[model samples]
Each structure stands twice: as structure tokens, then as C-alpha cells.
Target: MRRAAVGSCPASKRSTLSLDDHAVGVGRARAQVSDVGRQDDPNARVGLHVDFWTVDDPDEARRLLAMGADGIMTEQLRRVATRGAIVAAMVRLTRRRFTVGAVAMASGACGGARAGEPWSEEPPPSRVDPGFMPAPPAPPSPDPRLAFAPVARDAAPPRSIWSWTTAEQATEIRRDEVLFTRESSPTLGRGHLFDVLDARAADGDPAAARLAGVELAKGRFGWSNPWATVRGATPGETYGLELLHIEMRPDTWFARVRTSHEAIAFVDSAGNAVDRGAALDSFERVGGILFEHDVEYTGACATTGSGGGGLIYREIYVGNEARLATFSHRTAAILARLEGDIAELSAFRDWLRYGGGDGWSAYSWSCIAAQLWRSAPSTSRERYLASLAFATDPYAPYAASVDAIVTELKKASFFTPDDPFTHAP
Candidate 1:
């Protein structure tokens, strides 16, 4: 179990040196190997096993081996091991065939010559044993899942969303448009539309699943069906309702459907769906209520000295205005609907306060407090305070905008010291 070490050789040398006398080993860096040199056959230098260090690239390892490296030290151990296994398998297969061929040749030569006589120019004829016939090659196994049934080109198959219109070649352009793009037939109604979409979704159609989820969340058909559909949905198909606040549990599906009325730019940051006008309207409606003073915008909010004094009044219509407006309008709409539902409100508040663990989640919570005061000033104020008290930890990251809204609301005359809303669980 002797250990070998790697050391550098002199710049003038053109080959690797093994210093067994000093009990030292020498190796080269990639650059050093090219400069101080490489041997055409480093293995020919007896008592030496050339090893390269820190090799991670597959091509670089192959190049080093071609240049006579006996082994390599790599951080990517799994990759190297996998390659070695593949090479070993190929060698084993070749060796088995080589052994068989060698035995066949030996048998022929043994039968041809006598012990003292010279060998004949032509080889002895091979005799087949009457009782020993080689078995014929095995027939290929057919796959049970596949069948090849040919159909006539002119035949029309049964109508389906998954299959093309023709049995063979497509005869008309957009032949399947009626199945997907067109409105449901007058006799079928909207339920049929959803049925088709749901069928497609269950069969692993992402686009159909997404569309069905979005439409179901919209609740145009009614609340009962959407709730039932989403409740029964498997993880494989969330029906585009993956953004629902999970902390709400059994009712989270309904919350997701309820909140769909307000457009939430869940993934995008460009504020493409943000309505700046609606946000300004919300701010105008609730500014005086939250601040408890005349709401007027001064340039002070943009400066560090403004502190928490100006708060929502100065910031709402300033930097990231569209985002603020969008958040205000969307959250306020959703919160307004949950006014009397204390259990749902608490769950929603928990999601807003604690879900900012990642960049996208943090951004989603940034303006969650926006326009909330405008929904129902007194109720909103109490709800906001209750949410703050419910938090076991500090507010999540990117919650400064939400904090500004809370700060402004604290100045109201109705602001209370104790929790405004309470429930057992």
C-alpha cells in the first residue's frame, strides 16, 4: 500500500521523472505539461505512473490519457466512474467473442495434422455431428403496447379532440378547430366546453389544463363547480391554480377561485396588467382615511429624511407606482370579499405575512397592503392590526411597502392597542 505524491519537475525537462531514490513523485499542471514538456510514451519510463490532478472536463481527461496519463484526480468522480463502467462492458463483450473464435480455429488445426507429418496446405473438412444441430436464432419479441393496423386514406375516424380529423392524411386545414377553438354548439352549452377541456387536461395536456384551471377559477359557471373541481384536482394538474395560498388548506382552493376576479401578475414583474388609473383611484379614496389628516403629496417621501412620517401618502403614487396600484387594487378587491369571513381573512393574512421566503413570493407580498384600507376603512384597519399581532416573527422580506400602509393606518382615531379580531383556531 505505497502512496504516490505529485511534485513539479524543472522547466528545462521535456519528460516526467520518477525520483524513487528520494521517495518523491512528480506531476505537471496543464500549462506546465505543455511548456516543460510531455513524453510521446510516458508509460515507457519504468517505475512511473503519470497522474493528472483536478481534471473535471471529459475532453480534457481524454486528452491527458491520450498524452500517456496513467490516472486522473477529478472532483467529478461519478462522471469518470460511469465512463469506466461503459468501457469495461465493451471489453467484456469483445473478449467473449475473441475466446469463441480462438477455440474454433484451434479445433480445426488439431484435426488437420498428425504428430510427425508436415501440415497439409488445405485444412481438413469440418464434420457435423448428426445429433448436434445448432438451434436457429430466436425471433424478436413484439411489444404488447404497439399495433400496426393500416387504414384507408379516404376513411373518416370518429371525432375527438386528441385525434386528427382524417383516418390517414389531413384533408382540410384547421380540421380540428371545431374541437378546440370554436365555441360550444348551441345545444351543448358551456358545460360541454369545460368537459372537453377537463378530459384533455386529465390526459396530460398542459395547455388544456391551464385553460380549464383559469376558466374554473374565474367562477363564471358558478362557485360550487369550481370549488369542487379544484378540491378534487391532483398535483399532476393544478388547473393553473398553483398560486393559491397553501396555508389556507381545505379552503385554499376556494380562495384561489375567489381571488381570480382580480388579475394578479403572479409571474411577470413588468406590470403589464397593472391599471395605474385604478390604483390612483383607490389611493385617492382611502388616503385621508388611513392618514387621519389632509392627504397631500410632497417631494419629501423620496428622501431618506421623510422616515415613517409621510408613509403611504407620499409613497403610493411615487416609485413603482404601477406595481403599488396593481397590488392595491387586486388585494383590496380580494380582501373586501372576505370582510365577514374571519377564518379566511386570517389565513389570507398569514399567507401575505409569511410567504415571502423567495424572490417571487417576496415580490407578490410587497404591495399586498395596497388599497386594502380603501376596501372598508374601519374593518381593514382592524384586520391589518390583527394580522400584525398574529405574526410570530418579523414581517417578511420586501414588506416595506406593506409596512408603510400599516404605519399610515395606525394614525387613525379608530386604531386600537389590542387585537381587533380574534378566533379560537
Candidate 2:
């Protein structure tokens, strides 16, 4: 696993946070950041999802508090000084709404289920009977061949597919691998990159125009139109468009078909146009084709900066619509074989968090960061900060998160702390 280097941001702007920066919240605001998106009322109570984790600096938290944050919702207490800093800041803000959840003390937030608490009212029971549920039927035993559980016994780990490298170099190298589908190309190659459409090619072209319109409709009505497809003249035969792969990134490459009016679209190789507000990388199973992210450089992504690149993982473009349905059925069998421990892991996660009681819900700020650092790519400074903060912490909880992630990773194969971000000193 490779960690993207911590890049610098302008001094005047918020400093770019690394993955190890951890700060814990003393309080838990019930409101989520998503609530603000629906209605930008700063006056209303809102919570920062990861705001209360441990961090070296309190400036970011202080700034957010100043902007009318109601309270900090956190799971664990950090260092005394860091805790003190957050407490001091919380005291300064007179407008914040405070609520005492039952577990607020361990979480370091103000509020609790005190007697006469306004939020402590109990609700009436539901009308449905609670004791009449039937016992679940036992699942059929799985075939031994289908199971690929992670081994528990200690052994030498499998070799990693690759080793450490910089994201810039990785991106450049991955870019070179994009092969374009040539005029005589029969099969789509891995590096074969092609543009869906261009400005000049789409302009005044009715086919391109229709696609553009569909794109607009997708934006306006998300997931509403299931029948949206290339309306007129497919790009391959109609436009005969070829891509300059050297310039295009895998995540950025897409096909576009013009239609009547000013409609234009970014489509997959199967000519399935992207819906509005949908990510291009998520264009999987378009016309029964499988797509996956091309680049392994899972780092912070931006509209302007680098993103996870893309490549056509499989080509399943059967000519007939009826045949496509059959192909889709066959593809399911293949995907079933490909699906790994995600389902079992997810079940474990739910059981631990929901059924394991109070202990499972709480985690050290640093530990959570460390787990995330090893498990997923950081796409924002905030996430990086949490990872870095937790990774560096000396606390037991920090170790717990790290150990948990390692254990989970080892379930499928042997685990190694090779990535610089997660390497334990």
C-alpha cells in the first residue's frame, strides 16, 4: 500500500492536514453536515462528523465553531491539553446548543440524560406486537470450494503485487498504459483510451446535441429516467471519433454522442450515457460491460486535481438487447466468484457496532484514523488529519483501531505494515 505524499497548501489558506492528525470532539451535535446541504441555515444546530478528533492545531475547529456550529460530537477524549483547548473554545461560544447524551461523559461532550432534561421524554410503544416474530430458517451449508476465509494461523504473508512509489509517478505510469481502441481494433485494450466527444465534434451535431441534453436531464432529475440511453447515432459509427490517450486520464476518458437539440453526453464504451450527478468512475455494467478504476493511486481527489483513473475492465457489449440480458445473467456468476469478504466483513462490522454494546461504539480518535488510512484512500485534508493524528497517538485506543484494521486485512491474506502512512515505529 502506498500513501500519497502530504502536499502543501498556501499559508493564507487552511494548511493541508496529514493523515495522522487526530482531534477528538468533546460533544456530539445531533445534526450532520448533510443537514446543512439541504438548508444552509448556520443558525440551526449542526455537527461536524469528524470534528472532535485529536489534532495538533485547534484553529480549524475554532473557526468552524465561530461559524455557528452548535456542538462537537465525538467518541473519545484526546490529550489533556487538546481537550482543554476544545473545552475553552466551547465555553467561548455562547450560542451553541448543548445536549447531554447518555454516553456524553466518555465522549467528552456537554449534556446528559439528567433528570428533567427536555430531550429525555419517552415515546409510546408501537401498535404492532413485539413477541410474535418467527425464528429464522437456517441457511444451506456453503460449498467448501466457494469459501475463501482469511486464515487465523500465523504464516508468511503473500507477496504484495507492487511496492511503494509516489502518486505523481504512479499517475504518469498509469496514464501511459491507456491503450486506445484503433480503427481496426477488434477488442478493447487496457490502455486503449478514447474520447466520448469534443466541443468541435459535438457542436451543431444533432447526435451529440441529444447526448448533451440527456446529460442535462440527468443533472436535473437524478435516477428518475431509467430509459435514458444514446438516443440517436452511436459515436463509433456516426462520429468515427478516436482518442488521444496520451493527453486523457483514465478517469477522465468517456464517449459522447450528439443528439438533436443542444444535448451532449459522456458515455461508456457501451454507449450508455452518464446520468446527472453521477460519477464517471461508477459507470459499471453499462450495456453489460464491467468497468473499474484504472489507477491504484488512491489519493485526495479534486475537480481540478488528480482522481482515481478508469479503464474498461470487461467488454460485454452484445449486439442484441435480448442477448445482453443473457450476458448480464452470465456476468452475475463471474461477479459472484469475484466478490470477496466484503459482505462478511460488513456483517461483522454491524454486529460489533450495533450488538457489542457501549464498548464497540467508542474508539480513540487516532485509532479510527489509522484504520481508515490502511483501509481506504484519503480524499480530503480532514480525513488525512484524523489518520495522522490517530496514527501518531500513544494511546491504547489508537492501537486498538490499528490492530482491528490489520486483523480485518489479514482475514483475506497475510497483513503487512509496509505503507509509510501506517508503518508502526
Candidate 3:
């Protein structure tokens, strides 16, 4: 049972030593032992115990044993404890290939557990297997609408030339037009002119109507399919709809157009066009303006005993201000401190640093209002609130996040100083 061991070393550093080097080191150490009685006893022996923080995999562990390792000492879950003594070189092997999962799977269970449950054994049936891997779903089809008209890779793409000398501000004008050429089409002029045409004419949108008007003015009246003809106008005369500030992110495509009219930006899984202007005037008749504000958003799950939910503070616009007559406990608390002042509300919202801001969650309406009220005149504050109160939606897309905002709006009330605010979940 006489054992000689080396402390644990990282895999990379240990890889540098060859088997001959390890054997030589162990032999040198064993040769130094001078117990005459032990030397005479054939049963008495000394061996090297190589230490590792983690075995790379089950196969690596078996290889280490075959490489003349008297024993392997590892911090991995394979070790067992009996009456506080850790016993190594156990048969238990992890199903996963990494040490990270090995530690996570066993660490939590080793602490004080329930009366009948022993910490040394595998976790209960309810525990999820860290090694279990899920199969990836099939890849989705590409959207045909996203097909870009090709141009020579070496040639510079035509830029949108704008009238910089005009009195019109850049904010008021749509300046992101791209010169539309047949070569620019993803189909490479393989499809007919009608292929690029709008399936239907713009109903009442002034912006869309103006573009449609330009198509008709090009002597395209005699054309049997006007919509496609309009879409197939001359390169300089027509622009890609994509040039319109379609704010695209890794996961979302938010157009520069009115939010209510966002349906124009829809693309199927295959990147094909579905419908444009489908959400036009969708929220115009819904009544009440959308407003943005922060609330103590919370939720919980009993299965995992995990509690607490994060705040919903990013671009959360609530529809129907009038429906806010029934305020929730959280909303009521926020309103009670504002004293019906608009400037304070503005400061409170502007100060919010969405993901992380120091003490951002502890902000009070009254303190924020008093600090910023002097910065803006009463008239300005009144106008800002008025704008928020009358905000209109022309591109209202159906989404759970948007739906939640609308639901909260229906339960929130306008902040009134005199009204007694009470907690009601």
C-alpha cells in the first residue's frame, strides 16, 4: 500500500513529459528509498501515482491506467467520500466528455440534502442529465424577397444621390433609395418585369401611393399588369423598397416606416414576400396613444424553485391611454410618486439604462421630477405628455411582448396626485 504521488498538473503542461521521463522520475524516487526491511520484503513496493484535475474522457482515463499509472487522483465526480475520507480510482465515469459538466452535475447534490436522499449517490429522477444532448431541427428555407440583384463584384454599387441643398431636412425625406437595375434583381433578369411588381397597389398610404404614382406616370398605363410594371421601372427611376430604413438586426427587422405599417417588412421563412401594408391603419382605430415606462416586472416558476423575473423596459409602448383607468399595484405605486407632472415622468424614463444602470431599479418619480422639472419649461413638459397621449400606430404587428404592453396599459391609470393609490396586484 506504499504510494508515491505527484501533485495535479494541467493537461497541457503534463503533455510535455514523455512516458520515459515519467518512468525515470519515479524510478529515481524509488531508488532513494533505503528501508532495508522493505527492500528485502518482496511484497513491499513503491509506485507513482500521477495526479490529474480531470481526465479528458473515459478512453483517456483507461489509457492513463495502461500507461503504468499506479493510481489516478482526480477531482472529478468519480471520487467517493466515506466518513470524510476521499477514496480515488473509482469505477464511476461521467457520460459527458468535459470536466465542466462533471462538476455541475454533482456539486449541488453534495450539499445538505433531504432526509432520505444521500449526497454521495446519483441525484433523483427529477434531476436533468447534463450529458443529454438534443438533436438540432431541420434548417429553414430562404426568403425569395431577400434575393439581392447581382452586380459585378468588382463594380461599385450605385449610391443614392440626394438634394443636399434643399430646404427640407434629412429627417423629413426618404434618402435611402438604391438604384434598381434588372441586374440587381436576385433572379438576374430571368423573371419577367411583373415578377418585381407590387402584387397590389398601395391602398391609402401617401408614401406608397407617391411611388406608385411615379410608376404610372412612366407611360406604363397601357401595361396589362401595372403593379409589376411599376416595380420594374428604369434603374434610376425606381428604387428597392429595401432602401427604406428597414432596421435589421440579427433576430428582427424593424422598418423605418410607421410602426403600425410594419407588416410591409414581413418576409416568410424562405425570405419570400407575403404581403405589404397588411397592418396599415391597424392601430389607428384602436384609440389612445402608446406610452413607454418602466414597471417592476416579475414572474416565478415552482418546478425549479427559481424565483424572480427581470424588468421589461425596452421599447415597451402601451396602447390606449384611456384604458389605464385600472392601475395595477406596481403601476399605481409608480404613478403615486409622480404628482401628475410630465417632466418628472420624462426624466424617469430617460434615466433608465435598460440592461444595467446603478440603482436603476430604485428610482422614484418625485425625486426625478423635481430634479428635471426646471430643465424643461412647463409648456414643453405639457407638449411632451400631450405627444405621448396622442401617439398613433400605423404598423401594429401582433406580438406577445406588444400584447403584454397593451394588457398592462388597460390596467394602468393616468397619474393623479389627489387620487389615493393602493396596492392591488
Give the root-mean-square deviation of each candidate in angstroms: 30.3, 23.1, 26.1
Can you rank all candidates by lDDT, best first?
2, 1, 3
Our model 3 lands, by Cα RMSD against the true structure, at: 26.1
TM-score of 2: 0.20
Candidate 1 overall lDDT versus native: 0.22
Give the per-residue lDDT digits (tens) of candidate 2, residues 1-425: 11111112122321111121112234222211111121233223212222222222356346434533212222321111111111111211111222211111101122112222222112212311223211222232221122222211111111111111224433433445312112222232221211232343344544333333323221110000100110101112111111011111122213322111133344443334556335333433221111111223333322211122221111111111221111111122222322333343333333222212122112233233333433542322223222221122121122223233333333313222232121110
Q: How well is each residue in 1-425 modelled by candidate 1, as lDDT tens digits?
A: 12222223333322222212111122222211111122232211111112223233456445545634322221011111110011100001101110001001111111111222222222233422222222322232221211111111111111100111121112111233111222332332443335544766687755345545533222111110111122111112222221111011121111111111222111112112224344333322211000011122233322222122222110000111111111111122223322323333333333333321112221222133222222232333223422221111122212232332233222211222232211111
Per-model TM-score versus the true fold: 0.13, 0.20, 0.15
Q: Lowest-lDDT window of 10 residues in candidate 2? A: 221-230
What lDDT does candidate 1 reach at residue 375? 29
lDDT-wise, the better of 1 and 2 is: 2
Off by over 4 Å in 3: 1-179, 187-206, 213-256, 262-425
lDDT (10s digit) by residue, model 3, range 24-85? 21121110111112323433322222222223245544554464332222211222222112
lDDT of 3 at 21: 20
lDDT for each of the candidates? Answer: 0.22, 0.23, 0.22
